[model samples]
Target: MEADKYVVVMNSEEQYSLWPADRAVPAGWAVQTEPNNKEDCLDYINRHWTDMTPASLRKG
Candidate 1:
C-alpha cells in the first residue's frame, strides 16, 4: 500500500498546515509545496514555521 500524500498549506495569517493532496484546498489557504509524504510535509513546516504567532499579532 502507498502512503497518503499531503501538501503544505499557508493561510493569510501565515499559519502553516497540512492538507491531503487529493482534496480541494480550502478557502483562504494556498499550497506552499508540492505533493509529498506526510512526514516530509511536517518536517517542512517544522523547519520553516519558526514563529507560532499569527502575522497580525506579531509586532515588528
Candidate 2:
C-alpha cells in the first residue's frame, strides 16, 4: 500500500483546539503562529514524519 499523507490531531474536527505552546506542543515542537480564527488549531502536516517529532503527533 501507499504511505499515509497527513496527520490529524483530534478525534474529530470539532476538537481542533490550540493551547499555549508550553501547554500544547510538548517541548521542541513549538512553531509560533497567530490565530486569525479557530482553524489554526488544526494544522495540516506533511506525511514525511521522522523520530524528531513527538510521538503524540500523528502520522498520516
Candidate 3:
C-alpha cells in the first residue's frame, strides 16, 4: 500500500495542521507547504513550529 500524501496548513492564529493533499483546505486556513508524504510534512511542522502559543496570545 502507498502512503497518503499531506500538506501543511496554517491559520490566522498561526496554528499549523496537516491536511490531505487530495481534499480542499478548510476555511480560514492557508497552505504552507507543498504536498508530500505524511512523515515529511510532519517533520516540516516540527522544525518550523517551535512555539505552541497562538499569535494573539503571544506577548511582545
lDDT of 1 by residue, 1-34 (tens): 4449999999988999999999899999999999
Candidate No. with top lDDT: 1
RMSD of each: 2.2, 13.2, 2.2
* Top-TM-score structure, candidate number: 1
Candidate 1: where are CA atoms >4 Å away?
1-3
Residue pairs that clash (backbone atoms under 3 angstroms), model 3: none
**Candidate 2 at 1: error in angstroms?**
39
lDDT of 2 by residue, 34-54 (tens): 432323334432222223444
| Clash list (residue pairs), candidate 2 | 4-60, 5-60
Candidate with better TM-score, 1 vs 3: 1
Q: List the lowest-lDDT window of 10 residues for candidate 1.
A: 1-10
Question: What is the C-alpha local distance difference test score of candidate 1?
Answer: 0.93
Q: Candidate 3, residues 1-60: lDDT per residue as tens digits?
A: 543899999998889999999889999999999999999999999998899999889964
Q: Per-candidate TM vs. native?
A: 0.90, 0.22, 0.89
Q: How many steric overlaps are in each model, in order?
A: 0, 2, 0
